[model samples]
Target chain A: MQLDATDRQLIDLYQRDLPVCDRPFLDVSRQLGITEEEVIGRLQSLQDHQVVSRVGPVFEHSRAGASLLAAVAAPEQQLDLVAARINRAPGVNHNYAREHTYNLWFVMTAPDETVLEERLGELEQQLRLPMLRLPMVEGYHIDLGFEIDWEALP
Target chain B: MSTCTSPSDNGSTLDEQDRKLVLATQAGLPLVSDPWGALGQQLGMDHEDVLSRFQRMQETGAIRRVAAVPDHYKLGYRFNGMTVWDVRDDAIAEMGQRVGELPFVSHCYRRPRHLPYWNYNLFAMVHGTSRDEVEAKAGQIRKLLGATSAGDTILYSSAILKKTGLRLRKEKATS
Candidate 1:
């Protein structure tokens, strides 16, 4: 999108997760020889441009929460309505529609399993869909980061 | 840069602009020779300015990563299992912290103690090319954490529903 060298460098930092610290911007500034204010300002520009999505916690579930990777199968005619209902659940982090038997897919996080059950049961009754609770059968030990550089590949 | 704290060290006051920056970097850290350069051009700032704030936000714990995301499945690691450990109440946090630091142990977290149903207070994801390989790895973790009793189930991804970095600023939905 016609990025300048400075802007490009900032994005490069973004491309590679920026270091987390008390003065994260300052840390980034030191590497690029820019002031902290400039870092803040440029980030605003990126947001204004809608080039970047979010700047929040890539929360490590291991921190302090109960989470599960789960899904729901909704009847075809009621798919959209069911999806909207499932998304409304407080603990549901992500939701999507797929061609598989399990049409609605999502991730749920809460303080505990009882909470998850309570919420899911309510959702099941409300949406009238059978919930397929597929908790992580195995703890997956690998990073699933998508390579943005693939766009640049020939 | 001087940290602008709003009387609360928890950093709950981190505003919109700050949130946007963290969200963008998390969502799309473009892979290019000059990714920041590209970002700055779009954002209307110089390279140095953008870099510094990333450091500041991270320091505040408003965001987590500014690094690479790897594809675990394609890396020849076949077996991926979520091993739920029923460790003592006090030991869960310490065990989780140490386990999370492991390069091989990718995702770790603590949930409720659901007995007979899901008694795991501490959960760690283990991956390897073969079932035996991952099992062996999981055994190693059990030994290290000194878990009382642990059970693991293999979860194969039937399909990925939606996988994208979060975008707080709300871009137009892509079809």
Candidate 2:
């Protein structure tokens, strides 16, 4: 979709969360010199368009909780079925088909470890596949949230 | 302060700017005096509109989080692994709640275990600043879950790789 200058401006604001306040949109509207309604209208447009995925508390993984990225190997024909099965499971945030031995891969997050194991066991039997749990061993960072294929401007 | 919200009824599809919003905010808003102000200036929109819209989007379910990405490897315990286990039915959800609370375990969930190399379930990511720290944490998990046997592969992230948020857009059908 072609992005107009104003749309780009709106998006830039979306990228940056509104201030933490009683009326964040109102605060933002005040800053940008636009009505709070306009702010809501544009965001509604962006979301209706599917440009934004989620917006909530940026949980500090290191400070408070934890998470992991892992994958599984599945026959090509069963990829769809397997993916659907995996995706159906609770706590399964995102899944990707990598060009590797592990054809099916996904990320999971939860409030706590006992949960991980019990569920892993159930998943194996339920989906009937070996869910290779390859968590991050060492990393300066573990978030794969960026645009993998974004072509930076020259 | 307000519960996050989304614009579920707007019905407008995502464009490039919207995509950029997902990408930029996926990581988390920067820690600054006027983070939204900066973002509005960059996008050329009124900050209030952006703020209100974000609140609305989060209030709805379309957008999931504005979570902080922590520096786990830096902090003491270092080893990280994708610990997969075999669990019984009717107990999976109960177990997930348990695993999610561990300070060391960053991620936990259930996924499909295909077969052969994949026959494990219940996944969790444990982070330690050190390898031994990671093992100790994993051992703690084993005790908590009561698994007969378990497996974990250490994914030493070779690189930082890609880190961004996803914004799924609907493509109009072509006649």
Across B73-122, the per-residue lDDT of candidate 1 in tens digits comes to 53344455655577777766677777676656767766665444445566
Instruction: Provide the lDDT at A118 for model 1.
Output: 83
Flag regions of model 1 displaced more than 4 Å: A1-105, A109-122, A127-154, B1-3, B6-9, B31-34, B145-147, B150-158, B167-175
Per-residue lDDT for A1-154 in model 1, tens only? 3446776567655544655444556677788898877876676565456444433235334222355666676788987777777677777767756555556768766655787678778887887766666565433322323222322222
Per-residue C-alpha lDDT of model 2 across residues B88-124, encoded as one tens digit per residue: 5456566666766665566676655555656555766
What fraction of the true Cα-Cα contacts (under 8 Å, chains A to B) does candidate 1 also have? Answer: 0.19
Q: Of the candidates shown, which would achieve the greatest DockQ relative to the real structure?
A: 1
TM-score of chain B of 1: 0.74
Q: Where does model 2 exceed 4 Å of error?
A: A1-19, A22-154, B1-20, B23-32, B75-77, B147-175
DockQ of 2: 0.06
Give the Cα lDDT of each candidate. 0.56, 0.52
